[model samples]
Target: MMKSSATHYGSIAQFFHWCTAILVLVAFMYGPGGPEHRVYSPVHEFDRRLHETLGLSVCALTFVRLLWRTIYTRPEVPPASRLMVAMATAVQWMLYLLLLALPMTAVIGAWLEGHSVTLVAGWEIPPLFATSHDVGGAIASIHKWLGDAIMWLAGLHAFAALFHHVILKDEVLITMLPSWLTMGRARTGR
Candidate 1:
Protein backbone atom coordinates (compact mmCIF):
# COMPACT_ATOMS: atom_id res chain seq x y z
CA MET A 1 0.00 0.00 0.00
CA MET A 2 1.06 3.57 -0.67
CA LYS A 3 -0.51 4.87 2.51
CA SER A 4 0.90 4.04 5.89
CA SER A 5 -0.85 1.37 7.93
CA ALA A 6 -0.86 1.12 11.70
CA THR A 7 1.81 -1.53 11.50
CA HIS A 8 4.32 0.08 9.11
CA TYR A 9 5.25 3.18 7.20
CA GLY A 10 4.07 3.33 3.60
CA SER A 11 6.32 2.97 0.60
CA ILE A 12 6.39 6.72 0.10
CA ALA A 13 7.68 7.40 3.60
CA GLN A 14 10.34 4.76 3.27
CA PHE A 15 11.42 6.22 -0.04
CA PHE A 16 11.76 9.66 1.46
CA HIS A 17 13.64 8.33 4.43
CA TRP A 18 16.20 6.28 2.50
CA CYS A 19 16.62 8.79 -0.27
CA THR A 20 17.31 11.57 2.19
CA ALA A 21 19.85 9.42 3.97
CA ILE A 22 21.70 8.62 0.76
CA LEU A 23 21.71 12.24 -0.35
CA VAL A 24 22.96 13.39 3.00
CA LEU A 25 25.80 10.88 2.95
CA VAL A 26 26.78 11.74 -0.59
CA ALA A 27 26.65 15.47 0.09
CA PHE A 28 28.78 15.04 3.15
CA MET A 29 31.30 13.10 1.13
CA TYR A 30 31.39 15.77 -1.54
CA GLY A 31 31.74 18.60 0.95
CA PRO A 32 34.93 20.54 0.34
CA GLY A 33 36.26 20.60 3.82
CA GLY A 34 39.17 22.82 5.00
CA PRO A 35 39.87 26.55 4.95
CA GLU A 36 37.42 28.80 3.17
CA HIS A 37 39.97 29.65 0.53
CA ARG A 38 40.49 25.98 -0.27
CA VAL A 39 36.80 25.31 -0.23
CA TYR A 40 36.04 28.17 -2.61
CA SER A 41 38.97 27.39 -4.85
CA PRO A 42 38.45 26.40 -8.48
CA VAL A 43 40.05 23.04 -7.70
CA HIS A 44 36.99 22.02 -5.68
CA GLU A 45 34.37 23.72 -7.83
CA PHE A 46 32.59 20.62 -9.03
CA ASP A 47 32.57 19.01 -5.62
CA ARG A 48 31.26 22.17 -3.99
CA ARG A 49 28.51 22.63 -6.56
CA LEU A 50 27.44 19.03 -6.29
CA HIS A 51 27.47 19.24 -2.50
CA GLU A 52 25.36 22.38 -2.47
CA THR A 53 22.93 20.91 -4.96
CA LEU A 54 22.54 17.77 -2.90
CA GLY A 55 22.13 19.82 0.24
CA LEU A 56 19.37 21.84 -1.36
CA SER A 57 17.71 18.65 -2.53
CA VAL A 58 17.86 17.26 1.00
CA CYS A 59 16.35 20.45 2.38
CA ALA A 60 13.46 20.29 -0.09
CA LEU A 61 12.88 16.59 0.53
CA THR A 62 12.92 17.09 4.29
CA PHE A 63 10.28 19.80 4.02
CA VAL A 64 8.11 17.53 1.94
CA ARG A 65 8.61 14.69 4.40
CA LEU A 66 7.45 16.90 7.24
CA LEU A 67 4.39 17.89 5.24
CA TRP A 68 3.75 14.24 4.46
CA ARG A 69 3.86 13.42 8.17
CA THR A 70 1.13 15.95 8.81
CA ILE A 71 -1.20 14.25 6.34
CA TYR A 72 -0.14 10.60 6.69
CA THR A 73 -0.48 8.56 9.82
CA ARG A 74 2.79 6.99 10.97
CA PRO A 75 3.04 3.39 12.05
CA GLU A 76 2.53 2.76 15.73
CA VAL A 77 5.81 1.61 17.23
CA PRO A 78 5.93 -1.18 19.74
CA PRO A 79 5.90 -0.32 23.41
CA ALA A 80 9.12 0.96 24.94
CA SER A 81 10.29 2.84 28.00
CA ARG A 82 9.25 6.47 28.20
CA LEU A 83 12.90 7.47 28.23
CA MET A 84 13.61 5.40 25.17
CA VAL A 85 10.72 6.94 23.30
CA ALA A 86 11.83 10.42 24.25
CA MET A 87 15.37 9.72 23.13
CA ALA A 88 14.12 8.40 19.83
CA THR A 89 11.98 11.48 19.32
CA ALA A 90 14.88 13.76 20.18
CA VAL A 91 17.21 12.08 17.68
CA GLN A 92 14.56 12.20 14.97
CA TRP A 93 13.99 15.90 15.47
CA MET A 94 17.70 16.58 15.58
CA LEU A 95 18.10 14.82 12.26
CA TYR A 96 15.29 16.87 10.75
CA LEU A 97 16.73 20.08 12.13
CA LEU A 98 20.15 19.27 10.69
CA LEU A 99 18.57 18.42 7.36
CA LEU A 100 17.24 21.98 7.15
CA ALA A 101 19.96 23.93 8.90
CA LEU A 102 22.92 22.51 6.98
CA PRO A 103 21.71 23.87 3.66
CA MET A 104 20.51 27.15 5.11
CA THR A 105 23.87 27.77 6.69
CA ALA A 106 25.70 26.83 3.53
CA VAL A 107 23.70 29.22 1.39
CA ILE A 108 23.69 32.06 3.89
CA GLY A 109 27.38 31.68 4.59
CA ALA A 110 28.28 31.63 0.91
CA TRP A 111 26.10 34.65 0.31
CA LEU A 112 27.62 36.52 3.19
CA GLU A 113 31.04 35.71 1.81
CA GLY A 114 30.02 37.34 -1.47
CA HIS A 115 29.84 34.04 -3.29
CA SER A 116 27.01 32.53 -5.27
CA VAL A 117 25.70 29.02 -4.69
CA THR A 118 26.67 27.11 -7.77
CA LEU A 119 24.66 24.15 -8.96
CA VAL A 120 24.92 21.63 -11.75
CA ALA A 121 24.75 22.83 -15.36
CA GLY A 122 26.69 25.89 -14.14
CA TRP A 123 23.61 27.42 -12.55
CA GLU A 124 24.24 29.95 -9.83
CA ILE A 125 22.13 31.51 -7.10
CA PRO A 126 23.62 34.87 -6.22
CA PRO A 127 23.97 36.00 -2.67
CA LEU A 128 21.13 38.15 -1.40
CA PHE A 129 22.73 39.49 1.73
CA ALA A 130 25.25 42.27 1.91
CA THR A 131 28.82 41.05 2.19
CA SER A 132 30.06 40.48 5.72
CA HIS A 133 33.12 38.31 5.50
CA ASP A 134 33.65 37.91 9.23
CA VAL A 135 30.11 36.88 10.00
CA GLY A 136 29.95 34.65 6.99
CA GLY A 137 33.16 32.95 7.98
CA ALA A 138 31.74 32.28 11.41
CA ILE A 139 28.61 30.78 9.93
CA ALA A 140 30.67 28.65 7.61
CA SER A 141 32.59 27.37 10.57
CA ILE A 142 29.33 26.37 12.21
CA HIS A 143 28.27 24.66 9.02
CA LYS A 144 31.38 22.53 9.12
CA TRP A 145 30.69 21.56 12.70
CA LEU A 146 27.09 20.75 11.85
CA GLY A 147 28.25 18.58 8.99
CA ASP A 148 30.33 16.56 11.40
CA ALA A 149 27.53 16.42 13.93
CA ILE A 150 25.05 14.96 11.48
CA MET A 151 27.33 12.06 10.62
CA TRP A 152 27.80 11.13 14.25
CA LEU A 153 24.12 11.51 15.03
CA ALA A 154 23.11 9.48 12.00
CA GLY A 155 25.49 6.76 13.16
CA LEU A 156 23.77 6.77 16.52
CA HIS A 157 20.39 6.60 14.85
CA ALA A 158 21.40 3.57 12.84
CA PHE A 159 22.86 1.92 15.90
CA ALA A 160 19.61 2.44 17.74
CA ALA A 161 17.60 0.90 14.94
CA LEU A 162 19.88 -2.11 14.91
CA PHE A 163 19.55 -2.41 18.64
CA HIS A 164 15.81 -2.49 18.27
CA HIS A 165 16.05 -5.18 15.64
CA VAL A 166 18.67 -7.39 17.25
CA ILE A 167 18.76 -6.88 20.99
CA LEU A 168 15.16 -5.88 21.49
CA LYS A 169 13.98 -8.36 18.87
CA ASP A 170 11.24 -5.94 17.83
CA GLU A 171 9.61 -4.73 14.63
CA VAL A 172 11.00 -1.22 14.85
CA LEU A 173 13.54 -1.68 12.07
CA ILE A 174 11.49 -4.07 9.97
CA THR A 175 8.58 -1.66 9.85
CA MET A 176 10.72 0.76 7.89
CA LEU A 177 12.41 -1.77 5.60
CA PRO A 178 11.24 -1.98 2.01
CA SER A 179 9.15 -5.02 1.12
CA TRP A 180 11.79 -6.38 -1.21
CA LEU A 181 14.41 -6.09 1.51
CA THR A 182 12.10 -7.85 3.92
CA MET A 183 12.13 -10.93 1.64
CA GLY A 184 8.40 -11.61 1.76
CA ARG A 185 8.32 -11.86 5.50
CA ALA A 186 5.05 -11.30 7.31
CA ARG A 187 4.17 -7.63 7.34
CA THR A 188 3.23 -8.09 10.97
CA GLY A 189 7.02 -8.18 11.54
CA ARG A 190 9.34 -10.82 12.92
Candidate 2:
Protein backbone atom coordinates (compact mmCIF):
# COMPACT_ATOMS: atom_id res chain seq x y z
CA MET A 1 0.00 0.00 0.00
CA MET A 2 2.85 2.36 0.76
CA LYS A 3 4.76 1.48 -2.37
CA SER A 4 4.08 2.72 -5.90
CA SER A 5 2.77 0.71 -8.86
CA ALA A 6 4.11 0.59 -12.40
CA THR A 7 1.17 2.66 -13.61
CA HIS A 8 0.67 5.15 -10.77
CA TYR A 9 1.82 6.42 -7.39
CA GLY A 10 0.43 4.84 -4.25
CA SER A 11 -1.32 6.64 -1.43
CA ILE A 12 1.80 7.14 0.68
CA ALA A 13 3.77 8.53 -2.23
CA GLN A 14 0.90 10.78 -3.15
CA PHE A 15 0.56 12.03 0.42
CA PHE A 16 4.19 13.00 0.83
CA HIS A 17 4.34 14.38 -2.68
CA TRP A 18 1.29 16.62 -2.30
CA CYS A 19 2.13 17.69 1.24
CA THR A 20 5.66 18.67 0.34
CA ALA A 21 4.49 20.34 -2.83
CA ILE A 22 1.97 22.51 -0.96
CA LEU A 23 4.43 23.36 1.79
CA VAL A 24 7.13 24.21 -0.71
CA LEU A 25 4.79 26.54 -2.54
CA VAL A 26 3.83 28.22 0.73
CA ALA A 27 7.46 28.54 1.81
CA PHE A 28 8.39 30.05 -1.53
CA MET A 29 5.59 32.56 -1.26
CA TYR A 30 6.57 33.54 2.27
CA GLY A 31 10.29 33.24 1.66
CA PRO A 32 10.33 36.26 -0.62
CA GLY A 33 7.38 37.97 1.08
CA GLY A 34 5.35 37.39 -2.11
CA PRO A 35 3.70 40.49 -3.63
CA GLU A 36 4.99 42.62 -0.75
CA HIS A 37 8.59 41.94 -1.75
CA ARG A 38 8.69 45.24 -3.62
CA VAL A 39 6.76 47.34 -1.10
CA TYR A 40 8.00 45.55 2.04
CA SER A 41 11.44 44.74 0.69
CA PRO A 42 13.50 43.18 3.47
CA VAL A 43 11.94 40.12 5.10
CA HIS A 44 10.50 40.88 8.51
CA GLU A 45 11.15 38.83 11.63
CA PHE A 46 7.69 37.21 11.60
CA ASP A 47 7.91 36.26 7.95
CA ARG A 48 11.45 34.98 8.47
CA ARG A 49 10.26 32.77 11.31
CA LEU A 50 7.39 31.37 9.25
CA HIS A 51 9.66 30.75 6.30
CA GLU A 52 12.20 28.95 8.46
CA THR A 53 9.53 26.80 10.03
CA LEU A 54 8.11 25.84 6.66
CA GLY A 55 11.56 25.27 5.20
CA LEU A 56 12.47 22.98 8.07
CA SER A 57 9.27 21.03 7.58
CA VAL A 58 10.06 20.67 3.89
CA CYS A 59 13.55 19.41 4.71
CA ALA A 60 12.26 16.79 7.10
CA LEU A 61 9.55 15.55 4.76
CA THR A 62 11.92 15.43 1.81
CA PHE A 63 14.37 13.31 3.79
CA VAL A 64 11.66 10.81 4.58
CA ARG A 65 10.54 10.79 0.97
CA LEU A 66 14.07 10.09 -0.18
CA LEU A 67 14.26 7.16 2.16
CA TRP A 68 10.92 5.93 0.87
CA ARG A 69 12.14 6.22 -2.70
CA THR A 70 15.09 4.01 -1.84
CA ILE A 71 13.04 1.37 -0.07
CA TYR A 72 10.46 1.09 -2.84
CA THR A 73 10.83 0.52 -6.53
CA ARG A 74 10.00 3.67 -8.43
CA PRO A 75 7.02 3.61 -10.77
CA GLU A 76 8.08 3.62 -14.38
CA VAL A 77 7.39 6.87 -16.20
CA PRO A 78 5.95 4.94 -19.12
CA PRO A 79 8.23 4.92 -22.17
CA ALA A 80 10.50 7.88 -22.74
CA SER A 81 13.83 8.48 -24.45
CA ARG A 82 16.90 7.46 -22.47
CA LEU A 83 18.18 11.02 -22.50
CA MET A 84 14.88 12.39 -21.27
CA VAL A 85 14.68 9.82 -18.50
CA ALA A 86 18.23 10.60 -17.43
CA MET A 87 17.48 14.32 -17.39
CA ALA A 88 14.33 13.75 -15.37
CA THR A 89 16.24 11.71 -12.80
CA ALA A 90 18.92 14.39 -12.55
CA VAL A 91 16.38 17.14 -12.04
CA GLN A 92 14.67 15.11 -9.31
CA TRP A 93 17.96 14.68 -7.47
CA MET A 94 18.71 18.36 -7.79
CA LEU A 95 15.34 19.25 -6.29
CA TYR A 96 15.96 16.93 -3.38
CA LEU A 97 19.37 18.49 -2.76
CA LEU A 98 17.95 21.96 -2.93
CA LEU A 99 15.12 21.08 -0.55
CA LEU A 100 17.71 20.07 2.05
CA ALA A 101 20.27 22.79 1.44
CA LEU A 102 17.91 25.75 1.44
CA PRO A 103 16.92 25.30 5.06
CA MET A 104 20.49 24.62 6.10
CA THR A 105 21.67 27.83 4.48
CA ALA A 106 18.88 29.73 6.19
CA VAL A 107 19.83 28.21 9.53
CA ILE A 108 23.48 29.11 9.12
CA GLY A 109 22.61 32.62 8.08
CA ALA A 110 20.36 33.03 11.12
CA TRP A 111 22.97 31.67 13.46
CA LEU A 112 25.68 33.90 12.09
CA GLU A 113 23.33 36.81 12.77
CA GLY A 114 22.89 35.58 16.38
CA HIS A 115 19.33 34.34 15.99
CA SER A 116 17.40 31.10 16.35
CA VAL A 117 14.45 30.25 14.13
CA THR A 118 11.21 30.12 16.10
CA LEU A 119 7.63 29.14 15.44
CA VAL A 120 4.37 30.18 17.06
CA ALA A 121 4.22 29.78 20.85
CA GLY A 122 8.04 29.81 21.07
CA TRP A 123 8.92 26.53 19.39
CA GLU A 124 12.51 27.46 18.71
CA ILE A 125 15.16 25.76 16.58
CA PRO A 126 18.64 26.98 17.43
CA PRO A 127 21.28 27.90 14.92
CA LEU A 128 24.49 25.96 14.49
CA PHE A 129 26.82 28.94 14.76
CA ALA A 130 27.59 31.98 16.82
CA THR A 131 26.97 35.58 15.86
CA SER A 132 29.14 37.17 13.17
CA HIS A 133 27.49 39.84 11.04
CA ASP A 134 30.04 39.62 8.24
CA VAL A 135 29.79 35.86 7.89
CA GLY A 136 26.04 36.02 8.20
CA GLY A 137 25.72 38.56 5.42
CA ALA A 138 27.88 36.46 3.10
CA ILE A 139 25.83 33.35 3.83
CA ALA A 140 22.61 35.26 3.52
CA SER A 141 23.52 36.34 0.02
CA ILE A 142 24.08 32.76 -1.05
CA HIS A 143 20.80 31.77 0.56
CA LYS A 144 18.97 34.48 -1.35
CA TRP A 145 20.51 33.49 -4.66
CA LEU A 146 19.90 29.78 -4.15
CA GLY A 147 16.34 30.32 -3.06
CA ASP A 148 15.65 32.27 -6.24
CA ALA A 149 17.32 29.63 -8.33
CA ILE A 150 15.19 26.90 -6.78
CA MET A 151 12.05 28.87 -7.50
CA TRP A 152 12.97 29.14 -11.15
CA LEU A 153 13.83 25.47 -11.28
CA ALA A 154 10.54 24.58 -9.63
CA GLY A 155 8.70 26.63 -12.24
CA LEU A 156 10.47 24.72 -14.97
CA HIS A 157 9.39 21.51 -13.29
CA ALA A 158 5.77 22.62 -13.26
CA PHE A 159 6.02 23.57 -16.89
CA ALA A 160 7.44 20.16 -17.68
CA ALA A 161 4.48 18.46 -15.98
CA LEU A 162 2.10 20.55 -18.05
CA PHE A 163 4.07 19.71 -21.15
CA HIS A 164 3.69 16.02 -20.38
CA HIS A 165 -0.05 16.41 -20.02
CA VAL A 166 -0.72 18.78 -22.89
CA ILE A 167 2.02 18.07 -25.39
CA LEU A 168 3.10 14.52 -24.65
CA LYS A 169 -0.51 13.47 -23.95
CA ASP A 170 0.72 10.96 -21.48
CA GLU A 171 -0.11 9.76 -17.99
CA VAL A 172 3.00 11.39 -16.62
CA LEU A 173 1.00 13.98 -14.70
CA ILE A 174 -1.96 11.72 -13.91
CA THR A 175 0.19 9.10 -12.27
CA MET A 176 1.15 11.63 -9.66
CA LEU A 177 -2.39 12.91 -9.33
CA PRO A 178 -5.07 11.51 -7.10
CA SER A 179 -6.96 8.50 -8.43
CA TRP A 180 -10.33 10.14 -8.04
CA LEU A 181 -9.20 13.17 -9.96
CA THR A 182 -7.78 11.09 -12.78
CA MET A 183 -10.60 8.56 -12.97
CA GLY A 184 -12.22 10.13 -16.01
CA ARG A 185 -8.88 10.40 -17.78
CA ALA A 186 -8.21 6.74 -17.12
CA ARG A 187 -11.63 5.55 -18.34
CA THR A 188 -11.18 7.53 -21.52
CA GLY A 189 -7.42 6.87 -21.75
CA ARG A 190 -6.76 10.58 -21.98
Candidate 3:
Protein backbone atom coordinates (compact mmCIF):
# COMPACT_ATOMS: atom_id res chain seq x y z
CA MET A 1 0.00 0.00 0.00
CA MET A 2 1.32 3.44 -0.88
CA LYS A 3 0.80 6.55 1.23
CA SER A 4 -1.18 9.35 -0.39
CA SER A 5 0.88 12.41 -1.12
CA ALA A 6 -2.38 14.04 -2.17
CA THR A 7 -2.91 16.72 0.45
CA HIS A 8 -6.66 17.04 0.69
CA TYR A 9 -8.21 20.32 1.64
CA GLY A 10 -9.37 20.84 5.22
CA SER A 11 -12.78 19.34 6.02
CA ILE A 12 -14.40 22.76 6.50
CA ALA A 13 -13.06 24.00 3.18
CA GLN A 14 -14.16 20.87 1.36
CA PHE A 15 -17.64 21.07 2.86
CA PHE A 16 -18.06 24.67 1.82
CA HIS A 17 -16.67 24.00 -1.63
CA TRP A 18 -19.04 21.12 -2.43
CA CYS A 19 -22.03 22.72 -0.73
CA THR A 20 -21.65 25.89 -2.75
CA ALA A 21 -21.14 23.89 -5.95
CA ILE A 22 -24.37 21.96 -5.52
CA LEU A 23 -26.33 25.06 -4.54
CA VAL A 24 -25.03 27.01 -7.51
CA LEU A 25 -25.94 24.21 -9.91
CA VAL A 26 -29.44 23.97 -8.51
CA ALA A 27 -29.97 27.71 -8.78
CA PHE A 28 -28.87 27.73 -12.41
CA MET A 29 -31.10 24.81 -13.39
CA TYR A 30 -34.07 26.19 -11.50
CA GLY A 31 -33.89 29.49 -13.34
CA PRO A 32 -34.91 28.07 -16.72
CA GLY A 33 -37.56 25.74 -15.34
CA GLY A 34 -39.53 28.60 -13.85
CA PRO A 35 -43.33 29.00 -14.15
CA GLU A 36 -43.13 28.81 -17.94
CA HIS A 37 -41.57 25.33 -17.94
CA ARG A 38 -44.30 23.73 -15.85
CA VAL A 39 -47.87 22.79 -16.80
CA TYR A 40 -49.21 23.37 -13.30
CA SER A 41 -49.50 26.96 -12.08
CA PRO A 42 -48.28 29.50 -14.61
CA VAL A 43 -45.21 30.24 -12.45
CA HIS A 44 -43.28 28.52 -9.67
CA GLU A 45 -42.67 31.16 -7.05
CA PHE A 46 -41.35 28.38 -4.82
CA ASP A 47 -38.52 27.62 -7.20
CA ARG A 48 -37.64 31.28 -7.55
CA ARG A 49 -37.49 31.68 -3.78
CA LEU A 50 -35.41 28.52 -3.52
CA HIS A 51 -32.96 29.88 -6.03
CA GLU A 52 -32.72 33.23 -4.29
CA THR A 53 -32.25 31.60 -0.89
CA LEU A 54 -29.54 29.30 -2.17
CA GLY A 55 -27.83 32.16 -3.94
CA LEU A 56 -27.70 34.11 -0.67
CA SER A 57 -26.45 31.01 1.11
CA VAL A 58 -23.61 30.79 -1.36
CA CYS A 59 -22.66 34.36 -0.58
CA ALA A 60 -22.53 33.64 3.15
CA LEU A 61 -20.57 30.42 2.67
CA THR A 62 -18.11 32.13 0.36
CA PHE A 63 -17.30 34.71 3.05
CA VAL A 64 -16.42 32.00 5.54
CA ARG A 65 -14.46 30.03 2.94
CA LEU A 66 -12.40 33.05 2.03
CA LEU A 67 -11.57 33.72 5.67
CA TRP A 68 -10.63 30.07 6.20
CA ARG A 69 -8.32 30.11 3.17
CA THR A 70 -6.57 33.18 4.47
CA ILE A 71 -5.81 31.46 7.78
CA TYR A 72 -4.94 27.97 6.51
CA THR A 73 -2.26 26.76 4.14
CA ARG A 74 -3.61 25.54 0.81
CA PRO A 75 -2.45 22.23 -0.71
CA GLU A 76 0.88 22.19 -2.51
CA VAL A 77 0.68 22.01 -6.28
CA PRO A 78 1.75 19.21 -8.57
CA PRO A 79 3.96 20.33 -11.46
CA ALA A 80 1.98 21.39 -14.54
CA SER A 81 2.33 23.60 -17.58
CA ARG A 82 2.69 27.26 -16.67
CA LEU A 83 -0.23 28.14 -18.87
CA MET A 84 -2.47 25.57 -17.23
CA VAL A 85 -1.50 26.75 -13.78
CA ALA A 86 -2.13 30.36 -14.67
CA MET A 87 -5.47 29.56 -16.22
CA ALA A 88 -6.50 27.54 -13.18
CA THR A 89 -5.52 30.33 -10.81
CA ALA A 90 -7.40 32.87 -12.87
CA VAL A 91 -10.53 30.75 -12.96
CA GLN A 92 -10.36 30.17 -9.20
CA TRP A 93 -10.18 33.86 -8.31
CA MET A 94 -12.86 34.69 -10.81
CA LEU A 95 -15.13 32.08 -9.23
CA TYR A 96 -14.59 33.67 -5.85
CA LEU A 97 -15.41 37.11 -7.17
CA LEU A 98 -18.54 36.01 -8.96
CA LEU A 99 -19.76 33.96 -6.03
CA LEU A 100 -19.51 36.95 -3.75
CA ALA A 101 -20.75 39.55 -6.21
CA LEU A 102 -23.84 37.81 -7.53
CA PRO A 103 -25.71 37.53 -4.27
CA MET A 104 -24.59 40.96 -3.13
CA THR A 105 -25.86 42.64 -6.23
CA ALA A 106 -29.15 40.82 -5.87
CA VAL A 107 -29.50 41.97 -2.30
CA ILE A 108 -28.72 45.52 -3.34
CA GLY A 109 -31.21 45.40 -6.14
CA ALA A 110 -33.87 44.10 -3.82
CA TRP A 111 -33.15 46.88 -1.42
CA LEU A 112 -33.44 49.47 -4.14
CA GLU A 113 -36.83 48.03 -5.01
CA GLY A 114 -37.96 48.38 -1.37
CA HIS A 115 -37.98 44.65 -0.75
CA SER A 116 -36.58 43.00 2.33
CA VAL A 117 -33.98 40.29 1.79
CA THR A 118 -34.77 37.35 4.05
CA LEU A 119 -33.03 34.03 4.54
CA VAL A 120 -35.47 31.13 4.70
CA ALA A 121 -37.85 32.48 7.35
CA GLY A 122 -35.03 34.11 9.22
CA TRP A 123 -34.78 37.84 10.00
CA GLU A 124 -34.86 40.22 7.07
CA ILE A 125 -32.05 42.52 6.07
CA PRO A 126 -33.26 46.09 5.98
CA PRO A 127 -33.23 47.97 2.69
CA LEU A 128 -30.03 49.91 2.09
CA PHE A 129 -30.99 51.95 -0.93
CA ALA A 130 -33.78 54.28 -1.90
CA THR A 131 -36.75 52.67 -3.66
CA SER A 132 -36.20 52.85 -7.41
CA HIS A 133 -37.45 50.22 -9.82
CA ASP A 134 -35.19 51.39 -12.63
CA VAL A 135 -32.06 51.17 -10.50
CA GLY A 136 -33.08 47.76 -9.17
CA GLY A 137 -33.72 46.41 -12.64
CA ALA A 138 -30.32 47.52 -13.92
CA ILE A 139 -28.47 45.97 -10.98
CA ALA A 140 -30.48 42.77 -11.31
CA SER A 141 -29.49 42.55 -14.97
CA ILE A 142 -25.81 42.71 -14.03
CA HIS A 143 -26.38 40.06 -11.37
CA LYS A 144 -28.00 37.72 -13.88
CA TRP A 145 -25.19 38.14 -16.39
CA LEU A 146 -22.57 37.58 -13.71
CA GLY A 147 -24.32 34.40 -12.59
CA ASP A 148 -24.19 33.11 -16.15
CA ALA A 149 -20.51 33.98 -16.37
CA ILE A 150 -19.80 32.08 -13.17
CA MET A 151 -21.66 29.05 -14.49
CA TRP A 152 -19.41 28.95 -17.55
CA LEU A 153 -16.29 29.32 -15.42
CA ALA A 154 -17.43 26.49 -13.15
CA GLY A 155 -17.84 24.23 -16.19
CA LEU A 156 -14.30 25.05 -17.26
CA HIS A 157 -12.99 24.32 -13.78
CA ALA A 158 -14.66 20.91 -13.74
CA PHE A 159 -13.33 20.06 -17.21
CA ALA A 160 -9.81 21.11 -16.29
CA ALA A 161 -9.86 19.03 -13.10
CA LEU A 162 -11.08 15.98 -15.01
CA PHE A 163 -8.39 16.49 -17.63
CA HIS A 164 -5.71 16.55 -14.95
CA HIS A 165 -7.12 13.42 -13.34
CA VAL A 166 -7.67 11.34 -16.49
CA ILE A 167 -5.15 12.66 -18.99
CA LEU A 168 -2.36 14.20 -16.91
CA LYS A 169 -2.60 11.52 -14.21
CA ASP A 170 -1.80 14.14 -11.60
CA GLU A 171 -2.86 14.73 -7.99
CA VAL A 172 -4.85 17.84 -8.87
CA LEU A 173 -8.29 16.30 -8.47
CA ILE A 174 -7.38 14.01 -5.57
CA THR A 175 -5.95 16.89 -3.57
CA MET A 176 -9.42 18.42 -3.37
CA LEU A 177 -11.10 15.16 -2.28
CA PRO A 178 -11.70 14.28 1.35
CA SER A 179 -8.54 13.16 3.16
CA TRP A 180 -9.88 9.71 4.00
CA LEU A 181 -11.01 9.12 0.40
CA THR A 182 -7.65 10.19 -0.99
CA MET A 183 -5.79 7.99 1.49
CA GLY A 184 -8.03 5.03 0.79
CA ARG A 185 -7.57 5.39 -2.95
CA ALA A 186 -3.78 5.49 -2.61
CA ARG A 187 -3.82 2.36 -0.42
CA THR A 188 -5.89 0.59 -3.06
CA GLY A 189 -3.23 1.39 -5.73
CA ARG A 190 -5.43 3.96 -7.45
* Prediction RMSDs, each to the true structure: 1.6, 3.3, 4.3
Ranking by lDDT: 1, 2, 3
lDDT of 3: 0.77
Best by TM-score: 1
Better of 1 and 2 by lDDT: 1
* Regions of candidate 3 where Cα sits further than 4 Å from its true position: 1-6, 32-43
lDDT of 3 by residue, 1-190 (tens): 1222336576777787889899999877765331222511336555556667888889989999888888777777778789978999999999999999988987887677676665545556789768997787678778779978998999999999999999988888887777677777778897
Clashes of 1: 0
Error of 3 at 64 (Å): 0.5
Give the per-residue lDDT digits (tens) of candidate 1, residues 1-190.
Answer: 7889998889999999999999999999999999889999999999999999999999999999999999999999689999999999999999999999999999999999999999977899999979999999999999999999999999999999999989998889988998788876667445
Global local distance difference test of model 1: 0.94
Candidate 1 pairs with clashing backbones: none
Q: Which residue window of length 10 is worst by lDDT in model 1?
A: 181-190
Show pairs that collide, candidate 3.
35-43
* Cα lDDT, model 3, residue 119: 51
TM-score per prediction, in order, is 0.97, 0.88, 0.84
Give candidate 3's error at residue 75 in angstroms. 0.9
The lDDT leader among the candidates is: 1
Worst 10 residues of 2 by lDDT: 33-42
lDDT, candidate 2, equals: 0.78
